[model samples]
Target: MSAEKIQIFDTTLRDGEQVPGCKLNKKQKLEIAAKLDDLGVDVIEAGFPISSPGDFDAVNAISKLVKNATVCGLTRANKKDIEAAARALEYAVKPRIHTGIGTSDSHIIHKFNSNKEAIIERAVEAVAYAKSFVDDVEFYAEDAGRTDNAYLAKVCEEVIKAGATVLNIPDTTGYCLPYEYGNKIKYLKDNVPGIENVIISCHNHNDLGLATANAVAGAINGARQIECTINGIGERAGNTALEEIVMVFKQHKELNLYTDIDTRMLTELSQFTSETMGMIVQPNKAIVGSNAFAHSSGIHQDGVIKNRETYEIIDPAEVGVNESSIILTARSGRSALAYRLKNIGFEVTKNELDVLYEQFLEVADAKKEVVKEDLERLMYQFNQTVETKFA
Candidate 1:
């Protein structure tokens, strides 16, 4: 069977910019949007046009710049917000108006100060309003993770009937377990009338560190779209990492799912996004982190030196990385040392390596890492000692 293509809806410029100190100007947003189009995302949520004049201009400019992917603008379940999003996306070849309301009881009561019936009415109105502006209208049920399954299904059904092209089930607070989020999608697939006519999208956050897992779970259960951001930058904890979800599907072929993303651009785009937003990706972050494919431990280094598969599930080059790094730390073993030495033009027998290992440890202990200069210095001293002893 052919692998099903999952829609990658990227909200980097919108949700990601919500992070403190991570805002992007119009030029920066356009640069990222063009790259996102090249990266093959299905949708780019540019910004909430009604929020600020800067955001409005950025979204409008991006709408004209993007070619392949749909340019989307976010809004609340109100006519004013929907109108602003529509105006901003006027020039997009493929434009989407994303507007929705909170469906969960907590959000309805505490956030909106409204009841389920009123919330449903507002959601339906928003979808209908957005549909008038564009053929593609995405209705997000914010906090759907905490919303009762049955009630959530009702809202989805109503919006779909009102011409919603996609249903966005967001774990607004990043508060759902994988199984729970999966089951929620499954429930809607089974219960929501006309659900098959519209796409089901998973918009997850990483407050509890389960955003990627939950997104995968949602896909396995029936969601056809995954809404994520570059480097997982967002409010609070973060959104699901785009690189993580794309790689998960790539690595797990048994799931029979795939995306159109250019995997080789993952590292480059990650670095660009990080630099543009001033957000540093954690060194241990999956896929695009600095140390993701670097091995320093003796045992692991030996395993990787023998074969990359023994230690890495994903090939470094597959994600645009040049090669695996054999980081020389105190924990690195002889095999790792030998590998580094050979790369720097030194060849040694096991006995010679044993002698060098002692010196290598002394230097490694003095510093966090051993660099090429340090290795050259070590070899020079060893050669000098040997010459003096022989003399």
Candidate 2:
């Protein structure tokens, strides 16, 4: 538990697949887990073994196949689920069994129709049962955001005493904001005994799109491990994105926390997940999106042509994206057109430039925006002129 390292626990094969239409077969689950390992996540949460036969076989296969990352299986607060998860993780060199129960009053009263004491007891028993089969045990507090902090502290302490090595606090409903989530972690850090000895992990959802922010805020308040997925794909609005968290750490080096993720694999892996899950990555989504590095405005394009830093912050190559784009559109200027044409290895004489410019404007008028291929075709229509460097 070095302060310099931030452990990444990827649940793409489990929580990510929990979405109804996104349910993956055994082979698909294992394939995703393998890719997650290749991306260098510290823990691979394979699946909830007892949830389904398909999940059981997938977890067992991943536990046997994935070598570097710790293989983990999820369980509820019951002995049957705990034992089933343990059976699934038995083949891994380093296996972790994660088990937990609801600690919040709303969940206990409405969801489970139980009392606080009974919920705490169930969590401790589950963690103890999981510990019987594996050295690594993680206990989670479902919907801890609305749970009374003091009661949550009591449950966490009891589970840790029962041999839980990692205590995961999930914002199950994605209801808490960053400021509140950070304070919650700080509260646990101050209240739970021997908390410093055991790793504290954060599992925030993105129901309100604050999962990544809340997770980073948790780290700032002393949580050491983060649970996430590549493209933020999960139930509801999705979970915190693995790529977003890694890039945030890279950009803010002052935090001094490091992850094992190879940033260069972010895009390829995101594309794979999007394609496999039958989901499309939004064109304007933060890091791995198609428009993440694309600029179209005249002023922005001018600065980008002069110096990339004028309009860009992170280099696209660092995140596995190829390059920034100067998209031509109906509103594009001659300077941007000239810049883009030269980038495609085309030169235009004064007369040819006028003709190409008119043609580009006509094409741009037809479409909302002119992309690289459109510009290439338009340039090809004109006589290739070998001219002096214009930039």
lDDT by residue for model 1 (1-391), tens = 8899999999999999999999899999999999999999999999999999999999999999999999999999999999999999999999999999888889899998989999999999889988999999999999999999999999999999999999999999999999999999999999998998989999999999999999999999999999999999898999999999999999999999999999999999999999999999999999999999999999999999999999999998889999999999999999999999999999999999999999999999999999999999999999999999999
Compute the lDDT for candidate 2.
0.89
Candidate 1 local Cα displacement, residue 130, angstroms? 1.0
* Collision pairs in model 2: none
> Model 2, stretches more than 4 Å misplaced?
1-3, 349-359, 371-391
Worst 10 residues of 1 by lDDT: 100-109
Which residue runs does candidate 1 get wrong by more than 4 Å? none
lDDT of 2 by residue, 265-310 (tens): 9999999888888888899988999999998888988888889999
Superposed by TM-score, candidate 1 places the C-alpha of residue 185 at a distance from the truth, in angstroms, of: 0.3
Q: TM-score of each candidate?
A: 0.99, 0.93
Say which candidate scores most in lDDT.
Answer: 1
Clashes of 1: 0
- In order of listing, the candidates' clash counts read 0, 0
Q: In candidate 1, residue 298 scores what lDDT? A: 99
